[model samples]
Target: MPGPAARDAQASGSPLIDTHGRVHRDLRISLTDRCSLRCTYCMPEQGNEWLARTSILGLDEIERVARVAAASGITTFRLTGGEPLLRTDIVEVVRRLAAVSGPDGPVQIAMTTNGIRLREVLPQLIDAGLSRLNISLDTLRRDRFRDLTRRDRLDEVLDGIAAARDCGLRPLKINAVAMRGVNDDEIVDLVEFAIAHDAQMRFIEQMPLDAGHTWDRSRMVTRDEILAALSARFTLTPVPGRGGAPAEKWALEGGPHTVGVIASVTAPFCGDCDRLRLTADGQLRNCLFSTTEYDLLPILRAGEGDDAIDAMLRSCVHGKLPGHAINDPAFLQPARGMNAIGG
Candidate 1:
């Protein structure tokens, strides 16, 4: 009884078109809940309790689920983690995901990494079909980097960024979480750094995802503040057609570079959000701020076919909330931190 469009939609396995018609085409998969750096905003300065090895999904499992998602209209996959590169089989992971295709053709593959170990894996990752990269660089000062991330590997990260550029990773990006009274003073410096390297810089407002539960809105820098700082030094022109993207981007007037701001706290983009997250342990998070997650490991390991997995995937997206509810007074921080949830 379905019409041609309905049949085509069903046949395509597009999960984004829920009953509410919110279509999510981007999927973020966390390879592991382990990390090399101790970023104060993401994790406690002391350390984190890592997920058990047995709990995490294998690379093959991740690939299988991703294949189904891609067939269902998921065109973008971004590998995240406490640090995804820390996984031993990361190259294979990329290789398998690179082969997945949707109605639109080959899926776009990208990653968000701390850039510590990128020096060793950048070449192989590029060869394995990684087309995009977003490296986290918080501070330009060596001492500040060490103090913030609790690691003395600033030089290594810089080298990784250079290597990523040299490897022909088109549109390499730098993500810096700007906080008031912390690294806010380095906005221009970070912008200059991105421009110098032919990379795009995105300043994200600090969110409430730290393991230490120390995110204070008072200390968080808003996008307006970031733009004000940038405007004082440079002329910025808005780039239209953000679509479901989290960052509102801009072009520096009279330059070939671009800058962006992900104002998750001050500016919410949940209405046009087109993302679904899968944690390292095979749990599906409908939203980054989702309080609950659906476990997929049991069903996956139970030898269920693609049909069953597809049903669960549909149910999860069907129940996805309209928004992340960050502005509501009732908004409670997610039980898991950003690193655990695949930031």
Candidate 2:
């Protein structure tokens, strides 16, 4: 991947594409295209026909992509998956990516996990140099949680979060995809839960990412709506972490820690977008809403080196849509499983 200077060059004097835009800085990588849960919003009633286990990216491939990304001025990244933890050698991948060095230095490594297998991997992952964990916990109610996630592991996830907290993982972020009349009622409760435990909570607005995600504007519990509910109990204070990333961060009124809202649907942050994504099999997606991907696997498997992958990354970033047309009534994300796309 082109370094920051080179990307800047691509965006300006030597435009990477038709326009002078060099945004897509955060690259979320999918280590595995499989998840343990079938959340109604993320999967079909009939589960996804996942890719064969052997087809997923190997550790070396993952390192190569990270090396390219790190080389290209890209420094911030997160590991996502059907469930990143489900991958057998996730710690090794984390170690390898964290090991990649840039002119400025190594990139930051983080992961979005389901938190089910977290207890088994927290210490090892911390040892591997992962700095952040975004655990998906939509509901605090056990029965409701089982109904939402379509599984029975709320206790396991909670335990995982507790274990992660104990392991000294600073800024451990808990992600809850708010659904109206479903999990929306739990917003304040969830925030309080996080406050009591001193963990950061983030309520994500359901994006129209996939039909399987069951994307519905009606279900979209907006940022204002969530914040309003929380404001009733605790005095809410805003934290200025918003820019390109999805979440708009805020600290609780009287609490010691903070919380966030990933208002992707209701409030799109496309203009400030600084993120890209790499699927496990080596397809690079520029915009989450647009399904077009530039294949890096063939280029990599063909024995092309970093330069080729870097160019591919540049092309992907260059080709990225300035902003998704999700708000348009005609907007429709392509039919691809979220797991396959590194959700």
Q: Name the candidate that leads on lDDT.
A: 1
Worst 10 residues of 1 by lDDT: 7-16
Q: Which candidate gets the maximum TM-score versus the true structure?
A: 1
Q: Write the per-residue lDDT of candidate 1 for residues 33-133, one digit (tens) a residue.
A: 88888888988866468899999999889998998898888999999998999999999999999999988999999999989889899889988999899
Indicate the TM-score of model 2.
0.92
**TM-score for each model:** 0.96, 0.92
Model 2 misplaced stretches (Cα beyond 4 Å): 1-8, 11-20, 45-47, 211-213
Candidate 1 at 300: error in angstroms? 0.8
Q: Give residue 288's error in model 1 in angstroms.
A: 0.3
- Candidate 2 per-residue lDDT over residues 1-343, each given as its tens digit: 8788765665421323313454445789998777788788887646468777666778888888877777666776799988999888888888888887755688888899989889988888888889888889999898998898788888899999889878877787888888899987788888878766568888888877553656768878888998888888777777775666677876676547777887777777887877788888888888787768898888877898777887787778768776788888888676676777886
Model 1 has an lDDT value of: 0.89
